[model samples]
Target: MTYEVLARKWRPGNFQDLVGQEHVVRALVNALDSDRIHHAFLFTGTRGVGKTTIARILSKALNCEQGVSSKPCGTCSACTEIDEGRFLDLIEVDAASRTKVDDTRELLDNVQYAPSRGRYKVYLIDEVHMLSGHSFNALLKTLEEPPPHVKFLLATTDPQKLPVTVLSRCLQFSLKRLSREQISGQLKTILESEKIKSDAGSIDAIARAADGSMRDGLSLLDQAISFGAGELLVNDVTDMLGTIDPQGVDNMLDALQDQNADTLMAAVASLVQIGGDYSQIIDALLLRLHEIALAQTDKKLVSDSAGNMDKLLKFADEMPAADVQLYYQIALHGKRDLPLAPDPRTGLEMMALRLLTFQPVAESKPVTNQSVPKTEPAAVSNKQPASTSTSQQPAPAVTASAVTNTASEASPAAAIAPETSKNITQNITMDSPWTDIVNALQISPLVKQLCSNAAMQKDSTFDVSLVLDQSHGQLLNKDRELELKKAMESLWGKTIKLKIELGKPSNDTPAATKKKELDSKQHAAETAINKDENIQALQESFGATIKPGSVRSRV
Candidate 1:
C-alpha cells in the first residue's frame, strides 16, 4: 500500500460517516428509505465540505447491487466499484473542464440509453456552476426530462452563478460548514485511531486554522503531524498556525486594564522577540475583550474552544464593564484601520496607547501639590486664613495647570446644588412633565426616546395615559414598554398602571428640544470663536483654519 493523506484516507464512505450535516443526511435518508427519490439532486457548499462526497454516496445508494435504498452494502459489486471510482454506470464529469456546448451535447446524447451495470445511470457533475450559458441551454431539456433509469447529481461551491431554470429543476441540499468543535473532535478520533501522540489543544489549534472545513482540518492535521515529528505539541501547533499564546493575550489585557503603558510595551516586546504577527495579536486581544464583555453580562459566557474561560473570567473581574465595552469598540475599530498606518508595529503601539488614553480620569491618582510649604497642604491652604499663608500665596484657579486638569477633579460642593435641583424638579407640576422625568429616568436610549415622544393624560383606570406620536410608534414595542414601566416603578417607588396610545403629540419631545438647544449654543460658540481677533490674526498670517463642526459650548 501507498501512503494516503488524512483527507483522502478519512473520506466519509456513508452518510453516517459524515460530520455536522445531520439535517441533509436525515432528509436524504428518509427520502431513500421511503423510495420517493427525486430525479435530480443539487448539493451546494464551500470547498472541502462534502458537496462532491455526498453526491458520490447518494449515487452509490441509488445503484447498490443489493437494493435501491439509503443503506448500501459496500461488499456488492455496484457499491464497491462506485466507491473505487471505476463503476461504468456512474459517469463523473468535471464541468469546470468540459463546459462548452459540444461537451454538454455529447453528455446529453447518452441520456437515451439505460444503465449498463447499475440500477440508475448517474451523471455526477462537479462545479456545475462553471458551465456556460450555451452549455446549460443545450442540456436543459435532458436535465428536466431524463430517461427513467438516469439520475443527475450536481455540485457547486457558488450556487449563485447557476441559472434559475437549472436551480428550479432540481431538489437542492445546501450543506453547512462544520463547526470548530466538530472538526476538532473528528481530528482527535482520526489521530487516536492512527496511534499518534497528540493533545487536545494542538488538535484544536489545527481545527480552528482549518476555518470550518473538515477536509481542510484533516489536511492541516497531516501537515502538523509531519512538522511535529509524529507528536503534536501545543507549542509546535501554535508556531505552525502563527497563533499567539492565550496567556500573552491575558497579560496584554491586564496591562490595559491597569493603564500601565510600560507593561503594555513590554508585552509587545516579548511577542516581537518570538516573531508574533501584529495583526493576529491585535485580533486575539479583540477576541479576549469581546469575551470579557460577554462575561460581564453572564459570567458563564466566558468560554472558548481553547478552554480559556479562566483567563476570560479573570479579566472580566479585573476590568470594569464600561471599560471593557469601550476597549472592545476601540480595538474593533483599530483592527480595520490598522492597515492605514505606516507600519504594523506603529499601528499596534498607537492602539495600545489609545486604550490607556480613554481610561477613566477618575481612576488616575490625584497629583500631589509639591510647591506647598511643609506646614500646610495646598488643598487645605486654599481655604486657610490669609494670615496663616504668610509667605507664598496659593495658586489661583485660573493657572495653566488648573485649566489643563479641569476634568481631573471638582469640588464636592459643586454637585450638591444640582442634586437639590433634581429633587425639586421631580416634584414640580408642569404641562410637559415628561421632559424633566425623561432627563432623570435611568433607562436605555431607546426607552428614553420612547418616553420623550409621549404625552401624559390622566385616566380613571390607569396612572397615566401615554400618547406616543405616530411617527415614533416603532419605539413603543412590548419589551420597551415593559422596560419603561419598570423604570417608572423603580423611580417613583410605586406600581402604577399605564396605557400607551399612538397619536400626534401636542408638544416637542425632550430629545428634539435638547438638540435644538445644543444647535443654538453650538452656533453661538462657532460665531464667537470665528470673530476672535487672535483666531482671525492666525488665519490671516499663517493660513491656519479651524475644523468645521468642532465648536461645542461648555454649557
Candidate 2:
C-alpha cells in the first residue's frame, strides 16, 4: 500500500467534479455538446484553480472512445488510458521544460499524422506561456491551420505573457479563484467520504489559509489530518496554523467593547502564550470586524464560515457603526507599521489601546433646568462686622482658586454645555445660518458634504426642509438623510423633522458659497504675487517665470 496526497488523490477527474470556475465549465460543455469545439482551447487562471485539470478533461472528451461529447465515457479504453496518463494519442507537454524551438517543432512534428489509437491527436500544453518566442512562432503556424484530426489544449497561470497571434487562434476560457465557502464545502465533502472526523473551526481555518486555491486547501487539509493523527480538531488545527482561537478573538473584542484595559492586556498575554505572528493576529481582528460590519448592514451578508453568527449580530448591535469604522482603520494602519515597532507584542498592545482611547464621543442626554442643581454664591470679606451680638468673627480670606472652584460648582449646566458643543453642534434652528451650521456640525466628512450641498427653505412650521440642487442629487440617500436628521436633533436638543428634495435652490448652497469665496481668494493671491515689487524685479532682471498654479490662498 502507498499513500497519495489529497491534492492528487482528490483531483477532479471530470468537469462535473470540478469546484468553482463554472463559467469555464459551462462554455466548454456547451461547445463539446454542440460539436463546435475549436481546434485550439486556452485555459487561464491562478494555480490550483483547475486550469490543467480542465485541459486534461477536455482532452478526455475529445479522445474518448465512444465519441466527442461533453460527458466522456470513463469505461472506454481511450478514457481510462487518458485518465491513467498512458493514452497513445493524447500527448501531454510540459511547456516550461521544453520551451526551445526544437522541442516545440518536434512535439508538433506529428500534427499532420493521423491518430494511431484515438479519433484525434490531442496536444495538452501546460504552462504554455513559458515557451520561447521562436517556439511560439513555430506553434502559431500550426495553430493557424490546425488539422481537422487534431486539437490543441493550452493552460497557463500568466496569459498576458502569451503573444496575441497565439491567443487569436485559440478559444480562451478564464477560470476564477474559488471562494472560501466553496473550498470549505469541498473539503467537508472529501472528509465525509474519507470518514475523517473534524469540526467547523478546523475546516474554516484551512479554507481561509487556502487563499482561494482548492489545491492549497486540499494540501493544508492533508497536512492537518496527519498532524492531528487522523481526526481533525480545532485545537490541533489552530496550533498547526499558528492562528489565534476564535474565542480568543471574541475575548479581545469583548474587552474592546467593554473598554476594559486589563481584560484587553490579558487577551494579548494569552495570544503571546499561544505564539504566532502579531500581524496575523491583527488580520484575524480585522476579519472579525469586517464580519461585524456586514452584520450591521445585513446579517445575511455575513457568511457562516466566519463562525458564531449570533455573536457577530450581537457585536454589531452593541458596537456603534462609527466605532467599527474607526477600529478597522486603526487596525489596518497598525498592521502596516507593525514591522517598525520595537517588538511585535508592544506594537499590538499600542494598536489595541488606540482603539479604546479614540472611540466616538457618546451621545449626551438632554438636560433641563430642573435636573441641574444650583448652588448659592459664597460671600467673602477682608474685614469683620462689628455689629455681631456674639464673638466677632474674622472674615475668611478667599483665593483665586477657591473662587474658581465655587463658580464651577455653582453652574454645572454651564460646564457641560461646552463639552456638549464639541460633540454635537448646538443652537441650530430653521432660521439659523446654513453656512455657519454646516461648518459647526460634528459629523463625518461624507455626511457633511451632503449637508453642505443643501440649502434650507423658509417655513412657518417646526419641520425643516432642505432643497438640494439637481447637480448634487447623487449625494442624497436615505442613510445620509437619517444621519443628518440625527445630527440636527442633537444640535437643537429636540426632535426634528427633516426633508430633502432635489430642486434648484433660490440661494447658493454652502458648498457653492465656499467655492466662490475660495476662487476670489485664489485670484487675489495670484494678482498680489504678480504685482509684488520683488517678484517684478526678479522677473525683469533674471527672466524668472512663475510656475502655473503655484499661488494658493492662505485663508
Best by lDDT: 2
Checking candidate 2 for backbone clashes, the offending pairs are: none
Could you give me the TM-score of model 2 versus the true structure?
Answer: 0.65
lDDT of 1 at 269: 72
In terms of lDDT, model 2 sits at 0.77
Weakest 10 consecutive residues of candidate 2 by summed lDDT: 363-372
Error of 2 at 398 (Å): 55
Model 2, runs deviating above 4 Å:
362-555
**For model 1, how does the per-residue alpha-carbon lDDT over 304-341 read when each residue is reduced to its tens digit?**
46546666677765566656766776677567667877
lDDT per model vs. reference: 0.74, 0.77
**C-alpha TM-scores of all predictions:** 0.63, 0.65
Clashing pairs in 1: none
CA error at residue 463 for candidate 2, angstroms? 52
